[model samples]
Target: MASFQNINIETQIPEEILIAQIMQLHESISKLESLRPCKQVNSLFTRLVKLCTLPSSIDIEALPQEVKEMRDSLINLSGHAEGLLEFEFSTFISLTPEPFKNVTLFPYYGNYVKLAHMENKILKENGMVNAKKVAFVGSGPMPLTSIIMATHHMESTHFDNFDIDEKANEVARKIVASDAALEKRMKFVTQDIMEVRERLGQYDCIFLAALVGMNREAKVKILGHIRKYMKEGGILLVRSAKGSRAFLYPILEEPDMVNFEVLTIFHPTNDVINSVVLLRKPKA
Candidate 1:
């Protein structure tokens, strides 16, 4: 009986073997998401940490060179996860800047760019506190992803989408209405934000994506509406392709706008500039 117990203990797995397995898992995740490689790899590594905690007999020091290589990949992937998210968001949103759609500079694409930046900024700043009742102004050419992410954060929220362009409004409406996550909470309206200022006060948060390059007068007018629509203690977020510091001058004076500001200026991810401005409303 003693001899059998000794044999069983000796046959147990080694820590080194477990580490090698972890490395392979990380590599597999990296391969899955070529664009979001780092995040995928990190996620795999996280899972490996859990697996390695098992009471195994593998020797940690016996890991092969290939396993070491995997460790290197994990480190590199973890280091760049944030940078990758930023780049992905920037390139996706402004695929088509103001002007002719076919222009090479303004390549029409999906809604990830705008949605990613806005969601990232708002979540990081507000920390998901009282994130209900969202209002989106100027739902742009593609705001499906933006509205979708917003619905995820807000609790039992209502989405009010306001847009002046009939075609743009239709596109956003179709996108929102089609999304099961947003359809229950979202409402789309084809109305100039300026004309609907009085009706906007009900929302707890407001999003303004790509309000740049419009006529200067129009920009100011829209800002006025945003100021009116945002609730006290709510949040107002803005994204722009130009990404300049001058973007916040128009609405800074609203007495209710929070003083702590978040300025996000990321390098062009694909071919588009990524700029974001986040302002929280005062609690009073």
Candidate 2:
């Protein structure tokens, strides 16, 4: 952790240098975790948090593996850090320049493409047609998933983009407005999921972004809330990373609190690790 602490957050460091620092810290942290006292572990967690809270202008692709490992460690060591990381990632995406804004940096493009394909496949398999109403929780600054769905489905689908970040909502609106087709079909809202609980049941499909809530408990609460409001027979598409990549974006397994029937599991055909779980609200 001390090796990572030497990084100058104020300056724009080269990607290679950052990666090297991250590797060193990762090795050291892994070796010392068992021997270090709780105080030392907490101190390392604090340093990692500072490293992760990089300026939004930095390219996420350039982010080193050490930073990702640190995130996983933080979640394992102190559950409270999940919220901090979520906010940090949201801020990083929100500050992305218009020209470079896509689903993510180029390395992650395949993930979104695979996600879009999985979404379409699930909708078709479930016999869902002309899904007129859709909602995306944690849509982020670009709302690329919603944009893709709208483009594929054309005028048949209308999307509501929700996020707690006002700045992200503003940017998402601009991204939508830039495309004439998307501008008419999408709406951005700056509010928590609980704030709009009353209207959830109206949507034919609801997308849960990988980083929607602060922690698993919060996520479970969100799942329970959605169960209460989602229309019977409606589809819930959850995006999650598989295995170790789950550190970056925690996976949402089937929660014990919800009674949703698993409709399908779509795996990525590309290098990306994310999979989409299509869940259906059973008719009671």
Candidate 3:
């Protein structure tokens, strides 16, 4: 059993103690084949969430293998818990301004920079000078990827961000509105991927967020919907995880979609696990 005795939610927890609790909880959960509705697992998950929420300046390279493994296990468990509990954990976390402002933004910015650079590389390789119109599916509370890409290209690009969650749309809109430059370049669309398919051909580039669908079947359906509407020669950038973090989303080694050809996979330059699958809709 994992004891979170040293964890105090009201105060900052030491990195060593936090890591120890994560390791214990991970060990307990790994022994179970399937997670059932239980107080222990729930408690462990709650504690893990709290620990993750705490401010940490620890260097990733200095962390032990056990600590790293435990952290990854917790993320996997968190994803499973969201499905089992019928809750949108990531969305809920995003709704809260404090943790997102302090903790989430740091890593998200790192990811955004890497993704922007990779997009630039891919565009250049494809002989495309600029992505004039871009659509970001599952934009969440902060469309960091779109924002970062827009910043990288200056005023040349326009972004249409779509998300099923109205709250997420509102939050993202608010963020964009705060920046005068972003206000002119970005717009949030409160629609599911299927609903937005009607205007898909308008975008030069499309970003499929990793959490766009709950499962593989849902993702395939989303992909199918886009295939029917995306313009010929338009680029589709599907964000996914690599290596151990692949559990964050349904791993699509090779997307079996019609009319789309895989161009390349963009791996992150930092610790962020996201990899972008660059696909293009071929000209007829």
Winner by TM-score = 3
Q: After superposition, how far is residue 191 of candidate 1 from its true place, in Å?
A: 0.8
How would you encode candidate 2's per-residue C-alpha lDDT over 1-284 as one tens digit per residue?
23544656565445555445544445555666352235565466545444444322334334467665564563454333333333344445445565224435432345566677677777787887788899999876656677767876535688998988787777567556655766777899888998787799889889888777545667778887898888999888877644323444555666533698987766553444456778889999
Per-model lDDT: 0.49, 0.64, 0.66
Question: Among all windows of ten consecutive residues in candidate 3, which has the lowest summed lDDT?
Answer: 99-108
Q: Model 1 lDDT vs. the true structure? A: 0.49
**Model 1, residue 101: C-alpha shift (Å):** 24
**What's the distance in Å from true for residue 88, model 2?**
13
Q: Tell me the RMSD of model 3 versus the true structure.
A: 9.7
lDDT of 3 by residue, 102-165 (tens): 3234323665676667767776787656678889898776576777777666357888999887
Q: Estimate each model's TM-score.
A: 0.47, 0.65, 0.65
lDDT of 3: 0.66
Using lDDT as the measure, which candidate wins? 3
As a whole number from 0 to 100, the lDDT of residue 4 in candidate 1 is 18
- In order of TM-score, best first, we have 3, 2, 1
* Off by more than 4 A, model 3: 1-107, 268-270
Per-residue error for 189 in candidate 3, Å, reads: 0.4
Instruction: Count the clashes in each prediction.
Output: 13, 0, 0
Q: Is candidate 1 or candidate 3 better by lDDT?
A: 3
Q: Of the candidates numbered 2 and 3, which has the greater TM-score value?
A: 3
